[model samples]
Target: MSYLVLARKYRPRRFEDMVGQEVVTGVLRGAIEDDRVGHAYLFAGPRGTGKTTTARILAKALNCVKGPTPDPCGECERCLASDEGAEFDVIEIDAASNTSVNDVRELRESVGYAPVDSRYKVYIVDEVHMLSRAAFNALLKTLEEPPSHVKFLFATTELHKVPDTILSRCQVMRLSPIREEQIAGRLATVFDAEGVTAADGVAAELARRARGGMRDALSLADQLLALAGNSPQLADLARLSGGAGLQELLGLVDALGAGDRAAALDAVAAWAGREGELAGALLDVVRSIVVAGVCGAGSPHLEGGPAAGEALLARAKALGRGRLELMLADLIRARERMRHLAGSERVVLESALLELCTLEATMSLAELEARLASLEARLGGASVAGHTAGPASGGQLPVSIQPTPPPVGASATRSVQQPTGPATGPATAPGAAPRSPDTPQPAPGPAAAPALEPWKALVGALDARHRTLADLLRRSGKLQGSGSMARILVSKASADEQALLADKRSRRACERALSGAMGREITVEFVVGDAATPPPPKVEQDPFTRQVADLFDGHIEEP
Candidate 1:
């Protein structure tokens, strides 16, 4: 075939030509320029991050006829052959297929030979980690110290698989994943070179789809060119890439933000059916929302177009920070689970979306805490404006604050103060008024009244917040005692409610509600019967008495 793919046609011919790998190329260039090139070199990173390509470029630089220069003259006979991958001196081997001790022995024997034409005999091994232990051991000595005319270039995606012994013998270079901007800039250059007309955003979209791999971006660009011919638009790129369109992704987010479970599920189902990586696309949108929430505005920092980003930002704000975080976490988990799940990706993805849509139903602790904070703020605002008084009125103080009573059974008695100003609490209800300080004090006899007051206030507070839970507590029992020791008499209707409240989370929530209402920490216990009254004891009867009872069909009664 006469046609060359973009990946090969645009392959970096010189160290300076490599993209998004300045460090690796700079080091190699300096090594060649200073004539300090090592006998063995290892390049490692993710796939399509220029490991093998850099190795090839390094090989060419060393073998060029114009001495060991970083810049190889493309017109030179040796450089031309090396670029063509046909040079007799620069041999490229796929270690994946040639992973044997015998192969290493053959390679070792060839390393000692002088170059047929080039200055240096370069051996490039791709996927070097695939070689077996025996193969590695066989080549260790040769790699550690090779002939003056010979050079070894090794490339691997998994650096950890390379033995430390092998690693110690070579100059290792770590390459990082290419950034999106770098990939997009490279794509734009390719587009211009090919005489293809594309929007600026088109290249960026393709770059994002590449997921930090330059080769992937170029390959995708090639596909887009073929599909759209000479003039490719952003829509064409999205269609060819099998990615969820901006509108579709935005619709999904809107559905979730609106709590429309069915719509969200439908969106997932459609996206899953059409796109290869539905969950990943959804995760991207969700992650963008989380970022936008943090930024507190709709910034066009995400992969999509401006309008889509704005819409997403608006939805993110409407959904609030807590819901966005939960949604983000759910999407991430679903994507991970999809990897291990077979033939059920759509089901899992839809289920995850639906779950996120109904996040309000399953309130997380973080959400509850945020709600409580808002409630506290409102209450605090109300408390500050509760009372005001003038000094001219009989020299009475304007502000009166009520101090909570001390624990029951304490020797000291604390009096409740009446504010001369308006009251703000529930105690200031229509008929209820604060007692005057001069009024005769009521004697405290039973501890039940004080103990029950807090519990009643707690029930009312719970009712205002969570009605169902408050109802459950109302049926649970009546308060029986005071102070550090108080009890609730459990009835038959509250058995199930009590069991449910026994959960650690539920119990803690109840305790928090009680503490907030009472303004102090108090211990509560559940009792089955009356705490003050004792049950009757049973007496055993003699055998004759039992026989007499049996004859009359009567049972003995306990006293």
Candidate 2:
């Protein structure tokens, strides 16, 4: 006899035999026992989760010869015939192959007839989502009000494709993927029954690789058995699956954490040479590292043994969490790209390893802040010392000496000169103070009064530094004071510009500029009111255009 694959050979013969689907099994069993069955039922979920199998089981429960029983008597001829796919009343259709309105119409017409031998006629439609829109519409009425003696079962991986009109007519049960531990336990039973002496870790690895699909897990185990013959060990399974040994993957991670690029690259090369599955190996290593970081060193459930777990913990400590997160993100991106780069797998894998090796191995954010603070202190001390050294003995500091003020004349000095007491000689003129031999007179203040609080100077600095902000501030108005607290009165025309000045950063900048101009600290305030008259909008000239005009001996117009 030909060897039967484990997937088919171990197919669940009874509801009790189904693994990791108790929710579905329990519901069906209750419905059967209570005789509260629906005319049409829909099962939806990921593949290999037993949707089709459950449909078959339900068929057997409904049509068994003994009675309409929850637990079908397998010994009976009707149940046995259904199990062998030879039952006359039970019909299994692959909707993916026959998805047309005509096919559905035929099904609808056939459902009118009663079962020949069984208690009810069962129609199981697999991949029902593949049906065309017209086909679904044709089946809708029949599904909603099928003959009393007929039952309909539909299974699909893509429930979204099934129209809501069709979905509302059936009872829907969503199936979940089987858990890894459950798959592992089932595989353990299979191994024991096959008289195979597999290592403890082998079944677990296969189960994880299956990604919660029992059929996939069973198929993978069957493949491993063929390659290793009976009594396969964990090490043998790992080698066959192109999976790097747990210890080796951990060592590679440690090398990367230490910033030992050469060692890390060498390890990657060795794994690539042995496994020829670089993407898979990289993904596995990345997954292990992430798990170890999250769960810590004592997690017994990690796919690789305890040694791999410890190595991951050590790497996590050495590399720090920030670097690990960045590396994981990079690996995820590389894994996605691997799908499209069919022929250049090795190049992609090596590039990912090189990136990992050159990862920024660094301390946590708090540690980095502390290191920066220390460096800044050292640099600040050096700057202070450099400033303390005096100018060279013969050298002089550059002094910006203003031209001696023109002898203060009567006309130019009157507006700013304070009234003087009786002049000692020649009766000094109106706006000029007389200087006495024994007492010198103080200098007159500015003609324009130097802007009450240097608010105009602050605005000028802002204009020079940032035109956008300056324009907004300019429309707002003139300064009203020169002391610590300075206020501006904005006209209604520019009230909308207040939002720009309200920003904390902009306010602080205005304060600094005001302080610099007035030679004292200053606070800024905005008051809304009508100004005497708004200032004319300043014109902006492009520097490049001005330079070109200068070269041509022409003036550039400001707009």
Candidate 3:
């Protein structure tokens, strides 16, 4: 005897045996039990999702010798006939082959005839949407008012193709795709029944590859069992599904995380010549990584199971949420672009992958923000050595802060603690004994004046008269000093700022603004000394940046 495939051998014999479609089955079961079974019913959903199977089971339930029962007795002749697809009262038609008006007319004529032996004549039409417009029109009246003994069951993947006239008469029951876990569980049952010893992840991998089709999963399992015999390896399942092994997918992600371009490229190159859908496999693995990152390592969506979660969680964390989002976007775009581009799939896919691996070369806004956030956290807790704490030269309380010079063996806490008086009282004279708090306070110096808080007022005073000079003075240095002598330090200023401030006119306007603001003659001196603001230090490149620069044959440019 020829062997029956698992899809057929394990076909659901009753409504209770159906998977992932509780609502549809429950409604049908209730309808039969309540004796309110509709004369015409429409079962619509994707292929291999039990639309046709449900139709057969419904037919058996209506035609069983015991009665029109919700549960069919399989031992009954009518139930056995329905199971073998040879019931005289249950007519199964393929609308694809017989789509003409004549075929539909014949069907209408047959509906008037009584059941040969069962309780009702059941017409099960697969792909019922394929019927021509003329065929649908010819059958519309008969479908609306079929013989009381005749029950119609229509199954179609494309529901929209069926005419409204036909659909309005039928009780539409939509079936859903089976869940991955459900499919995997069923496959495990198949493995036990078939006496097969499969790897732990093999059934799960097959179920995922089924894309929510129980029949497809069972068929794949059967194919793998035939090819690999009773003991099927994980590699056999991987080969059957046209997906890379879990370890290979993990290795590629690891290469990306470590910025190992050669390794990443080698992995891609290895799959370039393979028969399987490499892009799809990579997409699935990447999707799992992203889901694991967002929902955590325990997410049920991780296709490779715990090993995948453990292997990819660190890499996901390392890539960060933003970079991972961009990578996923790039991957999706590459897949879409490949659909239209023939012979360029490898080049496009590899280029996109390389870009992800070397993301620093083109940091997205999110990636830049992520980098800045990390830097900010590190800087917030940082300490400087010998950092000075002094008021601005203008007696301006503190428009800007300066880092103290490193004092040997001591970390300096830079504070913006400004005194109500000048010079913080002479800086304690380098090594003099600390002054007693009760010691008489010194009188105000000639340069000491009430602090000018709004530096913009001083700058704006000259803005109307000398906009360029105002801009230069504004850009040139951190202001300090007070009445009669306003100092503008120029050492750390940019070359252009220094040159602009050095001009005689710009200096005179700055002096005028300072004097006006102080309500006294303020001599502005542009000084260069230890007190001058220091130029910003060059930022050291991180390894991620270095790797990106190396990959792109580029260097970091200063802004």
For candidate 3, lDDT tens digit of each residue in 160-240? Answer: 999999999999999887888888888898889888888888888788777678988888888898889988888776566
Which residue pairs does candidate 3 place in steric collision? 387-404, 388-404, 392-480, 393-480, 393-481, 394-480, 394-481
| Residue range with the least summed lDDT across 10 consecutive positions in model 1 | 410-419
After superposing candidate 3, which stretches have Cα over 4 Å from the reference?
241-286, 301-304, 312-315, 318-559
**lDDT winner between candidates 1 and 3:** 3
Q: If scored against the real structure, what TM-score would every candidate get?
A: 0.60, 0.57, 0.57
How do the candidates rank by lDDT, highest first? 3, 1, 2
* lDDT of model number 3: 0.66
The candidate 2 region of ten consecutive residues with least summed lDDT is 410-419
Tens-place lDDT digits, model 1, residues 1-559: 7879999999999988899999999998998889899989999998889998998888888888785789988879888998898999888989999999999999999998898898889899999999999999999979777899998899999999999999999999999988877888898888899898897588888877776778888888888888998888877865785566656677887776655655765665456454237777777777777776666444546654566567767877677776677677878887777777776566566556645644533345565456556555544443333234222212222221222232232222111111122232222221111122233222222334444344544455454434444565565444433333333333322222322333223334445555554555534443333222222212212222222223233211221
Instruction: Give residue 377's error in model 2 in angstroms.
Output: 14
- Which has the higher TM-score value, candidate number 1 or candidate number 2? 1
Model 1 segments more than 4 A misplaced: 242-288, 295-312, 315-559
Pairs clashing within candidate 2 = 453-481, 453-482
Which of the two candidates, 1 or 2, achieves a greater lDDT against the reference? 1
